[model samples]
Target: MSINFHEVKKKREEFWNSSLVYKAIHDRLVKQGYHLIGTIGAVKRCHWTKEAVVRKRFCYKCLWYGIESHRCIQMTPVAAWCWNRCLHCWRIQPEDVGMHWDDTRPPVIDDPEVLVEESIRVHREIMAGYKGNPSADQLMVEEALKPKHAAISLTGEPLLYPRLSELIEEYHKRGLTTFLVTHGTRPDVLKSLVKEPSQLYISIESWDKESYEYFNRPLVPRAWELFQETLELIPSFKSPTVFRFTIVKGYNDNEKALESFSRFVEKAQPTYIEVKAYMFLGGSRGRLEHSNMPSHDDIRNVGRILSEKTGYKLLSESIPSRIVLLSRIDKPIRHGKGCPDGVEHPEKYAPAFSKEYEELTD
Candidate 1:
């Protein structure tokens, strides 16, 4: 079905204002200034916790959060509309929840400078009441209020935004690092990005083109070709690249599929590989059975199989969410100079080419 970006945008606005989940999340993000958006149910199910929130506790299990103890500030840039309605996605839907392109994206302010100013202003207003909340940790609260990094992945394909490259450069000039997560549907947009992000992530949900189409429900006609092309070009860029595979039980979790996935990773040679289990949420309930969410052991087994095939070591695992990290043993850690943890600052980290772009643009 061809998506009308304008209608998608309108529906998203209506949904964002009316949906309890969206309001709950928006309220928290506005108050805290930043928050991680991912599968809360997966986190809870893995951790065996009654709490439904996906927060620092769950983040502590993640490779990036585990490695960087002092780092603060994380948020997916936009809250609505994604280009692909992946069957594995946990977000609830009638399949067009927010998938619009027209004027649906937040309007491009007349002045970039004004947009920055308004962003800061809105951020402060959202955080106003939290100033005196007794339960709030002052240090973490302060960090959350600051705009250190913007992750361009929340619910949608950020590259679809016509002004994405411009927005990335603007963030870079503000000394904020940008993290872009793409579904690998648009290589042209990826290629055109002016500022290299601290990290560029491509999600490869399935190894085979047919399985990819079956799983991702991408809007583009030739998504598989685009995914392959993007993987091939990842090595040429200096910024850290991550290949994310959200493992679904009956779909691509078997040995043959995993082996094919490993070969793709070997060819791409990204700095990191994340293997995560699919969580049952949102619109996925209609299309997938609850049994599709794999167990922690299942996730670990898959990781082991892929690791052996790719010669990548299993570096970390978020036991609660059944997620694992794999990396080449020989991959060198290029610690950014400003990062105190010896790991790149979550916000300052960018692809190696970002500096060149920054210099050229200046």
Candidate 2:
């Protein structure tokens, strides 16, 4: 029997459009100043976006990781969808309850070109509110209006968006840098990308299947295997790739998982290894206690373990975000205004980005 994709989409839209639970989700997001994309996509101002607007502090990605958050537009192409309901996620929504799309995927999707245009336009509209404020930094506003960076990670799994490659191309054509983060559930989507982002991040919240279930609460089966597929493909990408570990205390943070974690990190040999602490915030608060939040020193200790196991040398850190950066010895951090051309650009020049970080010697 053949599947009716059209019917599948229609049913999904009906569920989202007519449900009050989802209505509440949309209402809350809109009130938070999130601009809707198509019927389901979304773009929102990052708290760092506000800081950059008012010229206070930039996001940790900028201060430590090199991307200028002040000139960044944080968004999600498939904002209302995700595969896992991780306990640490800040965006707690009714739409995220499922592991896959309604039946399969959204019935209606905004064109990649149009969504790109709308994303920038919507972001601009949100920024309009800060224009007349007395405290707003006009210089920052001017630079921000002409966004040079895009963090496609505000909420949801960006890979779920069809034409995601085209979306990246559109941003690149307009001279905007792209940073895409995925939960690693869609390795097939990752493999098919025609145009890679300036920076690609695959989040690894767990090292084993048991830890994955306990910490991630994936809505679908074989979630761990799916994540592994993405992990194995990371080394082959044309652009700079990263494996991000969002560690929650007493979940996947113990030494028991460290050896498995080391084995996985060897696959991508990412340019940077981010050992980030999970914060107790938003919907996560309802599911986990504040005690679950890890301290900076805790993350540091874990970073050291990863460093010791993988040979990546510890680099810089942002204490506020409670994250540490580990660099592959020979890779020498390469960053620039736009794409880090081979070195500055994150294209798939395998020779340069070659292998896991292994500089430390004990």
Candidate 3:
């Protein structure tokens, strides 16, 4: 069924206020140490934003923060409506089917400028206490309050946003780097995005077409073909690419699937591969049992299998969440060839912060 953007928008607005799906997402973000800054925070943290403080706070605190403050900012494009309803998804509901631009409704501001202004206001209010916290360093606290980077995979398929390319371009102009994640459901939309992100991620949930359909429940008519097309296009792009595999226990966890996935990755030749376990949350609870969540040891074993088969080496593992990052040993080049130093050169590309922030109303 084709999606009706306006009708779906209204339903999504209702869902935002009443659905468990919204609560699940809010809870998950909080647990992951992310503050829902929305659009208001986006304006205040204009130049020296710490985007990572909200989306990847757990990672920032443990790995990137003080040890490598230079790499601290990271943010997600807080929006909704994904192209697929995978059984393993932790943040959405099973009933949430099909694609619709209106997935994130009530909170939606008219334009990017208004959104940024509101973001600054909301962010300041939320982080007011950190201003005087003795344990927090002045610099760190300040950085944490700003929004530096953006991850365009907060909820919905960001590519579906009518002005996604413009939004991305705006972020680049502000000196913020972009990390875009797509489900490979819309090759046309993926190809149309104007800006080149620092890193691009394609979620290849299953090995075979049948498994993909069974697992992802994609809305697009030609989902499999689009997935293949997306893989084929990855090599042509200069940006670093990642193939993320969300491993679910008793599903796509065997050696055959691993071998298939490795072969596909070889074709794509991405810079990094992230293998993560499926957490039992949201609609997945009704479809899958808690036992479906694999243990960290299980993830390690699977990572080893893929590493050996694909000639990739394991760089790190998050034991608690059963996630692993594998890098191609021979491919020494980082995700963004020019971004090796972790510094964003806006003159070379787009600015990271939005220029609209300058005109935001109080």
Candidate 4:
């Protein structure tokens, strides 16, 4: 007799939805601005998106890579599943509420196409609030309704979602660019992707395995080995790869840490590196001190040191976001298809990139 996988998945979904823990957790998440999409997917409005719509201030991603902030849908497939409980992460933790669930995955999965469709619907509903506000830009607000990009890194481990490649493909089919960020623990999933995102990011805040365990607080064993495996696999990707470091003051910014990070950077040789300061917000405020959030100058200092060691050029900096972008090439890779009006005149919007880094760095 053949076992029915769909039946098993349906039963699992029923069990998850009927549990008291799920009800409690779901209620809290709903109140916290996370709109659940399908069975396990979620979409939340980014603060930067609001800034872009109301104040004409874009995020570091927009300033660096031409991603329109207001027109980006920030969604995640596995909203409640993550292998690591990084103290710096702003998302609420299950342990905080005296609850625990499987960190590796959800009880059941949703179809990639359904999740994508529902995500856009929910994103538009969330963005609708701006239309009534007098301060919101009507033109940008209208553009936001038709999202051009999907940021699949909101609050969970995206690689854990089994059908992530299909999800990326679905978004691409709808003429949207996808940006996937992972913790670099799932090499098998990364290697098996039938369709890759427009850009991929591996977040690294720790230098060594010991620091990885301490900082990331990974739930699984041999996480360091898994991370190393993913790093080695980065060079094989066709899409642009990025190493994002969320630098917390007095922790991963020391000289010894930079040296260890340099060794890994040499091995991966990613196209770009983002040195970003950790923001003290949400649940992270409970775990770390206020001083742990580094200033813009501190980010640049660490970024310069890492650039020198890794031979990557310091390309640009976004002071408002407290982040810096470093790249192997001189110019940024711009995507005009997803951008509004099929053009992203970066120089017109981002005046900071006007001067050459040779003069700025010197």
Candidate 5:
């Protein structure tokens, strides 16, 4: 019998882990406690993960709305994959986003079950380091050990993962609240999801197609069409939906872009809108200069413009993270399912305080 060495070699090279370039990245990620899932995904510890345990402070989300930061896991089902090589992105885009993963011919696509199992294990392992820290709070540590929330956005385009719904279900089954962030590139995938995330976020890079293409550098031919489709479906979803904007100064920060953004916001009619500054970090540092990183004041000024254009009340601001929250006056704080600490449910409004941390960073 003749062995097919070609197939074996192909399988081995699929991981890209052996390549010197990828190896360096993998090593650094592992050092920071990132757990690789199958061939193209990863789960990493959130800064809030450690802060929640140490009693320092929760993520702006916890401070804004109310989720136990320690009880949340940060993961991405597709880490080494994305359709847009966004200039402001902080994570490494494994490939120059082309038509789609199928068209891109990714090396590996792991089972959802394995991804979940390994994700939990790696998250726990990362937290294990905090056990010995003097500032660790025993109560919060135990809570952290038993996570109740999952943010499926460590990096990459999660919806690109074929089995993301299953992954979301897995987390939901485990009693964990889930959030799914998409770049509004694949409304077809979003439409098919039966188990929508507890909160759904569509990251809007720019309002105008020209700026959108410039900022996102998408691989697909009609990327703007996909975004428009996503906006159309926003109000139809029973689940709370949000539009997140990562404002990069001198690029998507001009008055024209903001005006266009307001038009898109009106069309989306999302439950909430988060305006955030684009930080200069990760592979983005190569594409954009530090001058591109907008200041908190810069972000606030744009937020003020958006509030005027959309009539979405300015809910709150996080000076440190360079972000602002806006909500429809009717649903601002009194109806997020519960306030100060609550998970939003579909059509089911809770409590009278609504402020969700709009995490736009990787």
Candidate 6:
């Protein structure tokens, strides 16, 4: 439980500036294994990052792209702010704990360089537990200590961080690839980024305005329009773009939804499309039913339909994650230092400790 308290005064200032909301949110997030860095940034060890070293199992990112799961840091610059309270998102939302604040921005903006450096420090501290595990490979654990990829989609709309472009640049300067995921609520932030991530992911959960409001529960006005603006902006990015669909069974997986999704794909023209099943974990368990979780076959079926609709061929499937990859090109674009040789592919194994390690940090 070694957390990065970069400046206690800054932490106090953040709490004072935002009333008690910040403290309440901070304690809860800390209990969830998120090490708060500076006033706003945080780093939480990914489940796959641990399993990669201890069990030789990697996440779908490793199979799809070449990210070595063990050598990746799952983090966020603004952990408590987001526009959308999507029903399927696994992270806890403000309202879930009977707390609400301005989700539009953070109470305090931390330095991006300090965020990157301290996040990596916390990442290594979190990995220390895995090093002593009997099943851990010492060599892999050593590599895990030196993270090479930053998954900046941990628990918030990272675009709200204000200095996100600088954060991405800091990570890149340290030789780490970044995968930034956003809810498409901030087209302005996307456009403003001078340093783009290695891969950009937009979480597109619904097809139309009605469904968007229904599932996303976005706080801002005209959220659908903002989303459309982001879709249009995706094609302008020089780096690879991804449209990620977290399919909730009997919700967005219907025929009509598929048609609308195809239309969105046409607009964005992202390098890849990921159709993944909505995971019934974390705060989502309180919002959605376990029955909403789709089967791997369900995901594959949807992938087939989208492939036909968008002409993005079904390139691969990671059955354990219930995710199918649709690509306009022949193969996935690898990023960062890839998984080492002879690593076990996730497709052959069951989902990586979904329940057993759901509570682990770092």
List lDDT for all candidates, in order.
0.56, 0.71, 0.57, 0.81, 0.71, 0.82
Off by over 4 Å in 5: 1-28, 31-33, 94-105, 329-362
- What's each prediction's clash count? 13, 8, 28, 0, 9, 1
Count of clashes in candidate 6: 1
Estimate, for each residue in 120-185, the C-alpha lDDT of model 1 and write its tens digit: 434444444355666544554454455454455645566656566676677678776666788877
Find the candidate with the highest lDDT and give its number.
6
Candidate 3 residue lDDT tens string, 289-329: 87887776788888889899888887655443356778874
Sort by lDDT, best first: what order?
Answer: 6, 4, 2, 5, 3, 1
Q: How do the predictions measure up, each by TM-score?
A: 0.69, 0.83, 0.69, 0.89, 0.83, 0.91
State each model's C-alpha RMSD to the native. Answer: 11.0, 9.0, 10.6, 6.2, 7.0, 3.5
Could you arrange the candidates by TM-score from highest to lowest? Answer: 6, 4, 5, 2, 1, 3
Runs of candidate 6 with Cα error greater than 4 angstroms are 1-18, 337-362
| Candidate of highest TM-score | 6
lDDT of 2 by residue, 231-254 (tens): 889888877777788888887787
Candidate 2 has its poorest 10 consecutive residues by lDDT at 353-362
| C-alpha root-mean-square deviation, candidate 2 | 9.0
lDDT of 6 by residue, 109-156 (tens): 887887888888888888877767889998988998898999999888
> What is the per-residue lDDT of model 4 for residues 17-41, given as tens digits with 9 covering 90 to 100?
7987887667767777787776777
Candidate 4 Cα outliers beyond 4 Å, as residue runs = 1-17, 337-362
After superposition of all CA atoms, the RMSD between model 3 and the true structure is: 10.6
Candidate 4: give the clashing pairs. none
Better of 3 and 4 by lDDT: 4
